[model samples]
Target: MFKLRGRLEKHGEIFEIGQSVKSPILAVLPSLATKFYSNVPTPYEIVDAQEDRKTYQGTIDNVNRQVSEGKQGRIFAVVHVAGKQFKITEGDVFVIEGYWPPDAGDRISLDKVLLVGASDFTLIGRPLVQKGLVRVEATVIEKTLSHTKTHFRKKRRKQYMRINFYRIPQTMLRVNRIEIVGEVNHPPDVTGLETRIF
Candidate 1:
């Protein structure tokens, strides 16, 4: 004789099966199937949400304190300017090639910051950092033309030759300072230009 032993559920109540059968069965049937299955989390996989939040808050506080005290050390930033990106620090001079409209002695603030770092922490942007977070100030020190380059082409059999020389305009920029002007994780309020003229 064979007996089937398993648990059955009906009307939110569980009832045991094969209890009254006196004959011994060669094999026992497993419990009823479940709709879904999930693995139990191990010790290493379990995370305490409160503790994680506390640690994150502590790190933000530390960075804020460092910024407040001005002890964060020399900061550096990667800024996008005039279709190019430049990794700049305070007092660094760099050149931009092309026709840029900014004239010499013009002070400009680079708004398209990609990354900013200090001695302790770094902030990276997805496409760009939050506006007003990192301020990179620079001045147009000089505007001049790059060294001339010759473009020559010749066809020996056809007796055709062409020679051209040209120079590209360049703008020299001196980074005045790079600083964190806004609190970490805090973004400025959004405003629209509804009432202003172009």
Candidate 2:
């Protein structure tokens, strides 16, 4: 057993050392920021956020105008799928290279949204946007194999030669639509408060 030179002093020193160790680890892990800072914007984030401390709702009048006018053809979202990201809009068709999980003709909801942009505003996620906030509904149009690719290798001054053929499975998706359901700052009520407004 070690002798304590006053319990408070020893505990305080240990606590300080523990905090010093955790500070570095916390800094390295971005996921811990929300717990430590309540998701407060960093200096770099503040600068990136239009160099203003205020949220992207730059003007109340502008928001009102956009609300009144309604969202049009400018709606689009950056969706993450099968280790790749694609910037997609409604009615746009894009092919997902390599093996994909969904079946052909299956309607799947893309929840890993990196960013959602409109004509007036942009909502960017830290790593991924919150699920259900920006809904990206897509349909698996077709699942097929890519064009035949031949891998050829030859050694100079040697008789070693090898050829390999591959046809990667590809998934074609049609973005059904992107719907920004609610405000970023506030979550819509269960009773359908958003429906009441324009």
Candidate 3:
């Protein structure tokens, strides 16, 4: 019907009225539904998931390749996790605020690498580096609540007072390692630059 056509157009879709396809409302609706989904935009979760899927079968494979070539050592990277950015190194233990889903003892890989580095080189991601290029592994060590904070308010001579306390859930993570599976630029060789001795 004409009403259906207008609604589809509002959603930025267009349809042509076929001359020979004389079908009832029931049969045409199914086909229209299919077309609607195809034209509509997908949720960001689906989009990021499809793009972030790791293609590398094994991080060890790339590590072996790096070892064979003797390219670099002591890799570090900035990764995004739990709605926050963290600069992490191997064997680092850090706490992330808020409740995270993964249970303790669960190992997880974070691929939202903003930048990866080594003693010799750096690879900067436009927003996020390509999937399977840099892998950051971590283990959920503990999940616990933070120390309760007290909020107290009082007005002199008014006899008004209020008090509240709260503890935020937090997750503890240990950075297992960061592996670079692709080529990167080497950092400048300035031993004095590290300590600002210039």
Candidate 4:
């Protein structure tokens, strides 16, 4: 059996794009950035990485840190969506409102992964996704909820009140390794898709 991309719901439904969607679908939300840069530096390398294991580990750690700083993430972010603060889990989809900063706006892809354990092997982004991989796409389902109220007061007369509400909805995405391209800079083409990730 295939493992779930994120979390499963009590009565949720899974819809895979190709073949048949056998997995469950939940609300999909993008991650937020803790900090940002006006110009995110391109992927780079650290010198003398293989001089020592400790040094190599340190270099890896530093690279990961840089990636985190450049990309948007849920870590250390105090999101106040819809007048409420919430921490997003790995599989959660949060609909954030308000003006998205230009640098922070747009589809910010995340590769600073915490942990990715597939059923077969636990490979890092060295070999991103395998060929014939599954592609997942989710739409903004809705916005978070908000409340509105009206009240009337009068001397000796009874008071009247009314209220309205709204909530943010979201679509969930669960994509698999449709095609493992073996490199991040060069993603392979997914079958049926017009273009591949560049």
Candidate 5:
């Protein structure tokens, strides 16, 4: 009778304890997880894409009367592509988004240049792409070594060696000319003054 009483008491105590103990996961855990994910920003949002288009409108300085000289050579321009900064070298090959050439792989000359600006002067043309100022054409010059990987195994131990190299294809460009189809407002008239100072 005593054993039976003890067993009954122990069973009752276990039931009470079980009811008092809380679950491993609290009710609020799910909410906290949801909140954490909701607050994080996606990788695509790191750079604001809308702002890149606005950069098109800006002052262009045509240094050394680059517009009038008609001397054709490689020119450097800072352009943004897909939320990234790109230095466009003259005679480089690049295709426009909407415009397509008859030859798929053939070099398409940029006839409608938007603006021409150098260190000295800036010439703004119509919305049309400048015929003479578009990117020049160059073929892939050479492909250099890009990367290398090596692995060695000795005495049950593994060793890894990795080398990385990046190469960009270069093109040869012969500048024909640069011409602005539209007009320039408040045209800069100063010519013979000190080219060094404003």
Candidate 6:
């Protein structure tokens, strides 16, 4: 007699009495085997710390050389603007929804950079990149209202109906340029309001 176990109890298997054999259920369902016997460690090769550091330093030096030579090529950046994040490149035009303070023709620098990329490499920031490292300049080209939207409500039996129309303000921005202004991994000094007196 063969005693089925767990979920396989419904799907019975035939075997000779007192015969010892591996579970056919595990053989049929490899995934279940992994769930039940998942303690096996995956194999990975280890590298020397000095060698790894040398490789990392070489990559940084290559990026720095490219930046210094002005050959990093067309750059792109993910910048935070008006509580929204936009992936922008030079000469790109994008819209910002809702009220913004910058007037048309006003030039501004987007400081909260989440990432910067070029043809060769990419730099990802933890919330934000180092200050003055990547500069993203843009111009407010126009400000206008979005298309009108209608909101309607109705109630059956009571015979109540309401209608409303609205439009949201939008700001248009044109990215002027994106460049690496400071060395990689180097941050500028933070001087907090030294010229102001309380």
Distance from true location, Cα of 191 in model 6, Å? 5.3
Candidate 4 per-residue lDDT, tens place, 45-108, comes to 6866457777756654654444435432222212223344443334456554543332322333
lDDT of 1 by residue, 91-123 (tens): 999999999999999999898999998989988
Comparison by TM-score, 3 against 4, better one: 3
lDDT values, one for every candidate? 0.83, 0.73, 0.72, 0.35, 0.38, 0.85
lDDT score, residue 44, model 5? 66
User: Mind giving the per-residue lDDT tens digits that candidate 6 earns over 1-198?
Assistant: 233343332235433334443666543443564567778799999999999999999999999999999999999999999899999999999999998999999999898999999999999999888777899999999999999999999999888999999999999999999999989976656655545899
- Model 2: per-residue lDDT, tens digit, 34-150? 555765556653256554535445653455456446743468899888888999999999999987789998999898999987777777888877555788999999999999999
lDDT of 6: 0.85
Assess every candidate by TM-score. Answer: 0.72, 0.61, 0.56, 0.21, 0.26, 0.81
Off by over 4 Å in 5: 1-66, 69-74, 80-84, 90-116, 122-133, 149-198
Give the runs in model 2 whose Cα sits over 4 Å from its true position.
Answer: 1-69, 187-198
Among these predicted structures, which one has the highest lDDT?
Answer: 6
Candidate 5, 1-119: lDDT as tens digits: 01111111231232222232232222213244355457677666555566654443342333323444654244455443323333455545443232222333333343334455545
* Candidate 3 residue lDDT tens string, 82-191: 78999999999889898788999999988789988777556678897655667799999999999998999999999999999999998999999887654432224443
2 versus 4: better lDDT goes to: 2
* Candidate number achieving the greatest TM-score relative to the actual structure: 6
| Candidate closer to the true structure by lDDT (higher is better), 2 or 6 | 6
Off by over 4 Å in 1: 1-46, 191-198
Worst lDDT 10-window in candidate 6? 1-10
Single out the weakest 10-residue window by summed lDDT for candidate 1: 26-35
Sort all candidates by lDDT, best to worst: 6, 1, 2, 3, 5, 4
